[model samples]
Target: MKRRDFILTAAAASGALALSPVAATAAPMVFTPGVVAKELAAGKTVFLDFKASWCSTCAAQERVIAALKAANPAYEQNISFVDVDWDDYGRHEFTKSLNIPRRSTLVVLKGDQELGRIVAQTGESEIKALMDTALNAATM
Candidate 1:
């Protein structure tokens, strides 16, 4: 292919990828001590994602969650999504308190009550159901 044609093709592909749904989805808030508690105290429902950067299971779960959120904007609007890096907070008191067993854990919390949880499962339907539970709790 001609250099100019290749360059233009590459630029077009990059722009398309940039505007993809996954790319447009908003990222969850990075976990910070007291942030979860603060959200709970304010009566907002929270969806906690415990993941590690290097874990394949975590990556799969993240993709499912992102897709679910992209499909349903209500999940993002009603639930306070927080991402807790397992490497940073795996042994932290907060994780221990929630009884999170491992990195690919997803938990939904509402006013000190855990509405639902998923561990290492990356099925789209399952993740969507979990997200639905969070949305229900949040709207309640």
Candidate 2:
């Protein structure tokens, strides 16, 4: 290939790679209440995202969590994420059990114990702090 053409192709490929979702982020697996129960029973750390599709705060939190996971794969691996779709399942039994007050609640739990929580918070630092609480509990 000509040098100019090769350079242009390489740059395009690099841009595509940089913009790829698989390269930029690692999304946590979605979990149901049953899975949360099982994981908790097995002494796993859990990050429960109580969210609604219409809630912008929830989307912000999701982005923060995704970024955090992408940054710290080792820490993320020791935790499980459960996205409770409050838009559809807001009134479910697990919501009642957790006493989740709204659509933007993020509950951190280690086993049957509550570690930390955030309600309608979008700050990345705050979300990371909340997640750190669960990770700390897991190590204890």
Q: Quick one: best TM-score, which candidate?
A: 1
10 residues in a row with least lDDT, candidate 2 = 21-30
Would you list the C-alpha lDDT of every candidate in the order shown? 0.93, 0.82
- Clashing residue pairs in candidate 1 are none
Among all windows of 10 consecutive residues in model 1, the one with the lowest summed lDDT is 67-76
Model 1 per-residue lDDT tens digits across residues 1-140: 99999999999999999998778788899999999999999999999999999999999998888888777778888999999999999999999999999999999999979999999999998888999999988887
Off by over 4 Å in 2: 1-25
State, as a TM-score between 0 and 1, how close model 1 is to the true structure: 0.87
TM-score of each: 0.87, 0.81
